[model samples]
Target: MQFRPTLWPTLITIPALVVLVMFGWWQVQRLQWKTELIQELEIRGAGPAIPLLVDARISAEDLMFRRVTVTGHYMHEAEMHLLNRVRDGIPGINVFTPLVRANGGGALLVNRGWVPIDWPGTSIEDHDVEPVIVEVTGVVRIPDPPGWLTPGNEPEKNAWYFIDLAGMSAAAGVLPFTDYYVFATGEKNLAGEPVPWLAPDPNEWRVDLPNNHLTYAITWFSLAGVLFIIYVIYHTRRRGPDDG
Candidate 1:
């Protein structure tokens, strides 16, 4: 008496398995696209900074990744450190300071840059630079709400996981500002090359994070394989001599 393979379970699952495989392949394609885009932006987008004048024509925060300059006073008294941010694999916090426009229209949140973890300064009063009218060139970046898996921001403790524009504006008490932030450029690595610093790169296929579509594709395909194996083994055992 022996058991054998049947068609019923395969019939039920083949369609589903095919769909999963297709999804996995789609993710792989997306990985290639994302890799190319990230490289392109980092290469071609790197350029000299644009100095934004007091009467500069702003897009009400519509622009992104475009290099621009904002010359103003650093309101260090209202600054806040973006908690748990990192740079070039170094543990540090992003310095968020409100750059009050010299012409007096309003202010914009400026990510001054990252300082070493050992650098002193936990409060807004611990400014590394003197308060003076200055010009800064940076890339425009839009604020994003914290991801679902990300922990919520703690405004009371002055710890932030993401840039909540409204919350920052209210907390800092500077207003009429645009709904965008600027990440100052001219930050060089030890090799003396410009780094994007805090650019809004959506789909970087980082090896450490590994959230690319290829990884997703592999997962779905692997699941399909497991499902097929299970269906075969279970149906084989279910078939008896009489059924055969």
Candidate 2:
């Protein structure tokens, strides 16, 4: 048998194989990175809630997914409503209120959790309670920048599609707000009205990071292998009596 691949097929196959293998390798790298990130988050999230200080020197990466406590009063008048949240098949919105910290710890945004979109009353006055100092415990979250598909926030209307820390702070007139926000854990009422606050388990991290990179890597590698096999079969030929 003689193995003589056509020039054009060889040229095309080599480059295609290289590209597929590179893609596979890239996905493998991503898989490792994502695994490490998930592990780190789980470790940090499992620890007891730490007291969050206004002047704490903790890096943003260190604070992510970690539970923390803060003493403050909710500035309900400046509440920002995150649109398009759903709970139990009911379309709703997540209410994010600025918490003015006690003893001058600066303000922190707290996601107070969801309320139905058609919940009666529109004004903040309808939801706010009498100003009272309180302590809030929840997980720290660093909001990602709004993607191209995200709708622009309407500060004038107090409607938000995504968390915009600086923009929300400025609009609410809360100076020097914390860069990260807390997803308040536990159910609570809005001035005697029912609101289903998210109560995530304090002992375990809710891992939502998708990890399909390994699957993707395997797919790419398999495709590369199939292509190589096909190329080989195409080029190989049985020798005949006329052959020298």
For model 2, which pairs clash?
none
For candidate 2, the per-residue lDDT at 171 reads 87
Taking the tens digit of each residue's C-alpha lDDT, what string does model 1 give over 179-217?
678777633233333322332321221212234676787
TM-score of each: 0.66, 0.82
User: Which 10 residues in a row give candidate 2 its minimum summed lDDT?
Assistant: 196-205
Give one digit per residue, the lDDT tens place, for model 2 in 103-125: 68778888876677887543477
| Per-candidate local distance difference test | 0.67, 0.79
Q: Which consecutive 10 residues in model 1 have the weakest lDDT in total?
A: 201-210
Best model per TM-score: 2
- Residue 19 miss distance in model 1 (angstroms): 1.5
